[model samples]
Target: MRVALKYICEDVDRHGNVRCYVRAPGKRKVRIRALPGTPEFMEEYQAAIATAAEAPLRQADEAKRGSFRHLCIRYYSSAIYKALDGSTRNWLRRALDEIAQEHGAKQVATMQARHVRRLRDAKAEMPAAANQRLKALRALFSWAIEAEETKVNPTIGVKKLRYQSNGHHTWTNEEIQQFCERHTLGTKARLAFDLLRYTTGRREDAPRLGRQHMRDGRVRFRQAKNEHRNPIDIDIPLHPALGESIAAAKVGANLTFLLTEFGKPFTANGFGNKFKDWCRQAGLPHCSAHGVRKATSTALAEAGATPHEIGAITGHTSLKEIERYTKAARRGELASQGMSKLIGKTTA
Candidate 1:
């Protein structure tokens, strides 16, 4: 309709109907009755009106071209799918679907900082969840801007919540010694634990280690985290217990070091479940395969290994991360030393 509709905003009428009011000079006010009046429905109705009002303006701006749906499809096809691994790509796809439903497809060109804030607020209870959503949205908008689909990125102004680190559980020296004593070699779970405690490799990387990685009296392999393709050389003499375990678990060509009951490479979650079961059988407190990495780091620092030396073996690129691991170990050692001195003085 070629009517000069001036949107005067929306309100709930006496009959509890959502009525969107628009005015035109020398004409009766046009009232569009929306669905039952609720805060959410009312907001959606108002947004719909705003979107319709802005359509002509958006069409005029050649720079603001595609809808949110079009941009999202382009983003997934272009860079996002390729950049993310399988598990992560699945998560981003699910989050993007929810975002599209809440905010209409056509509102991409008209999206502002407020819309980003709304999305963030909606996901506020779970900061990590919110951050992931924001990251995916930001990446989509960035692609849109680069592809000349939009002039500006509305997500630029959205702030991220500060991340608080909740430290993972690590095995105590007594616990580690007891667990090792209880668990014997030849078992897949025990072998996996032995390798993790010694090498400090990630759970994913542990299965990938093979006879080829063991050479020149050192274990060498590229880290999966950065895919830097630089081999980490570990000089810490391989423990005889771990050595025997590896030798026993040796597989023929075309097989990984660690495998599920089905004789295939252990998927990350499958390995974790087996590790947890092993811990339970050994009567050890709940500790993850990743905890072995922390335990190894602590053990190295306690044995007077320098941060740089530890980083080389652990494949840590930065000294800061090394210090954090060592500092936690140091704190426990220092506290024990102080208590020993106090006890000795009192007894003497």
Candidate 2:
């Protein structure tokens, strides 16, 4: 059923609880808890609509001065939120907005550690989602505390959920070979695969890469995610595999090697969706864009590239990320050396 405006829709699941939310502008759809017909819900819809002009200024200057909603609005306007990349900012806004709508009237100074933990526990099944929500909340509280809007940050000691599972399955050499064999050179699939595997850039930055970044056979770009905080200029020499794939594909005047069906440059999300289709077509549903990045790091580590070398190419700020690969490579190297010495003794 239609809820309030053209922007909102009401959803009733199999169990029959209703949820009303904004349905348009794609990414900005927010599910506000109040029902469509209620006076309170109408007021909220109006407030959300009204905030289009000046969201934070309205909150700070309005009557609900010390409320949690006001604090969130203020935080959104704060430099902390502004510094985040597009995707991160979107996620943070959604998380903070939900909290604001729920506990908007509550005073930020009164929030305790218990409140933070309870918020975390609500998304118990998905550790990542739970952590993301908690992270956004922490940023908000931390910003508030710094501004002296609140005396204590509620999320100070609340720990992230401990879970076991390899996050994204890192593709092995065999899997990469299989994918390549299935999707031969001269195809978009191969080009996309080679672009990510060869460049070792995150999926977010993949769509932004093109011929312009190339200089003396190296691809260079500032990483989109954490560019400001951990700024590093990435310049990776073209991998032979990627060079061969690109040569075969004969990519034309398009800005990036990957493009949509319409031949337009892809948005970051568009490229990911297109790549997933390529993987499924190759019967390598288990493989992914990010997995290709892992494979690149693994190859470098196995080939004896230092953490600093890996960081230079991948724009990684911390040694911790490449430590696993380096450690494994060291063990393999030692084992090979020891086995060779043993073989020499037996032969002698």
Candidate 3:
């Protein structure tokens, strides 16, 4: 039989089996195969060749080109959607969308280290901002690699920019006393600070503490930042200032202890801003809500609390973070001890 060469691609297996792929006219795809050393096999193969004779010539096209924007969308929609929480997912989506808009439509496969470096350089002035941007990019690229969108992640070797961290601005004893004197009770801002200093919880978790959380002479609530459900049992007892402040605040049957000026739940950001205002009014240094947590940890360590004990209260999973806080606290304690020794020598 005369076999037309126009339509199929052929390959012979190592075991002498001949395999034929059909490329017939008007067919988008085709498959054909034949047994080894058989006349019938050759006959069928020739028939397939003849059937594909009038088919259009096929040329290999580049893999379906995908842009950075396209791959990012796929990454976010697929893996990131399921993996991240609502707040984090929303932040990543917004940040990446903005980045894509700025960088134009470039193929993901073609994105180079240089492009990422340029973006990193532009954000170098703001380390925290740059770090967040890098994190989002890293997550996107990681997703892209998992989805087979790219073979290499340009963000692999990139390092996050570092900036000086203004350590926790915990209020001094005098500062705390002064702040309490200037601020009146019954206000959300005042109650918020008192509770924060007393409980040592994250800003988000502070407002969630209600009368229900207080039991058996201890404040207990799950940490929000880490979803750690362990209760913080403070044995030192709540200070009179905090106890009186909570008692003076209006508590509705359905409402929690802390509420906004309008009686709604207090958001972390809103409470932080108000706390800063209170600090300014009391002539104190600007301190974040997190500072309260640090201060509490410091105070606990200075009072001879063990690392394990401090971890229980702070919800620290590892001793490393707890150690850092305790180390600072210990340093302060040593300073006090040194002063006491000097005073004793003079008296003697």
Candidate 4:
């Protein structure tokens, strides 16, 4: 069999066992055990491609001692960065890589808090992005200080930009109805929507969910985020709507309720992008999977559920996090009840 993917090499051993490896330049050959073209194989292949893609830049950074890129190269190899979760590591890597590309040649020792502040301010137009960049820089510099790669942490005094934002837009009741009316019960879009709405799981958690997580009319799983540091286990009773959607949609022997068009499970980022396309097709350009989670919290809050009660469904670890989700709804519900009592007092 012929393989067309770049840098992929396959060998047949004397006993006729097929061995595959990704042999990219400047990096050690990584063995890929899964059969070619399978979902597992492609996942491993894509990861190898990403690591190999960094080889060229890493090689260049090695020659420039004490430079920012050199520091980044060291940071990437550090245990601190490796300890992060996959999605977090990817997010931080993209931010740091962009910074290194622009200012790779600068000396690490010269990066003061002022310099870091300037970088933060330069991206002020996008406050969230600016804050994210600042956060990535702080982590990099903190790691460098601990490793003795640098003396001082330049991001010590730097603060993230303040912005008034409600974060992801929560889907309204009307919007939910609109989406349901458009997608119907048996469609993949509806199942995806139902999972988001009823389970209230994060986008990353959705891909990992399957029949294995369901038992006795409840779904239980640990959140993907910070599972290593502070694991939060959530067990939510299955919603009738979600159960109906699952039965209506096509379910094969696959472990997950949602699978790619290729009949394989989705990566977190991949599913999010696919969900966006589904939303667009339903004429919901602004609504998203995260928004549905927020909507679930809002519904519970408006129904007079306490913050702790809401946290049970959302798997929020702190009262503060749940409050952020339910504050508006709670206030409105309280005001409505107060006004109804005041009207009764006046009539009496």
Candidate with top TM-score is 4
Give the alpha carbon lDDT tens digit for every residue of 1-348 in model 4. 544888998889999999999999878999998766444576577777888886467566668999999988888788878677667878898898888888998898888899899888889999999999999998898888878898978898788888899888999989889888989999988888888888898887887677777789998988878875678898989888878888898676566788888666787789899988988887899988899999988888888889988888888878997886577877776798889989857753
Task: Please write out the lDDT profile of model 1 over residues 59-102, one tens digit for every residue.
Answer: 32323346676566666667545455434555676788677654
Compared with the true structure, model 2 gives a TM-score of: 0.77
Return the candidate ranking by TM-score, descending. 4, 2, 3, 1
Residue-level lDDT for 180 in candidate 3: 72
RMSD score of candidate 1 (Å) = 19.2
Superposed model 4: Cα runs more than 4 Å off:
1-26, 29-45, 58-60, 340-348
lDDT tens string, model 2, 254-277? 556666686555666667887888
Using all chains and alpha carbons, the TM-scores for the candidates as numbered come to 0.66, 0.77, 0.69, 0.87
Clashing pairs in 2: none
Query: Which ten residues in a row are the worst by lDDT in model 4?
Result: 34-43
For all predictions, the C-alpha RMSD in Å is 19.2, 12.0, 20.8, 3.7
Residue-by-residue lDDT tens digits, candidate 3, 1-348: 434445656677899966667666576434554442232243344544543453332122122247666666566559445455334665776678778775536777777777787787787888877778888888888877887878978987888886788566876677667877887788666788878887777776776677767667767666555232333443335567778888876666533576656555555556667777877887875766778778777788878899998887677778997888788878876898899989857753
Q: Which regions of candidate 1 deviate over 4 angstroms? A: 1-65, 79-81, 84-91, 101-106, 178-182, 228-239, 250-254, 280-285, 332-348
lDDT of model 3 at position 281: 80
User: What TM-score does candidate 4 reach?
Assistant: 0.87
Please, what is the whole-model Cα lDDT of each candidate in the order they appear? 0.68, 0.76, 0.67, 0.83
Model 2, runs deviating above 4 Å: 1-63, 333-348
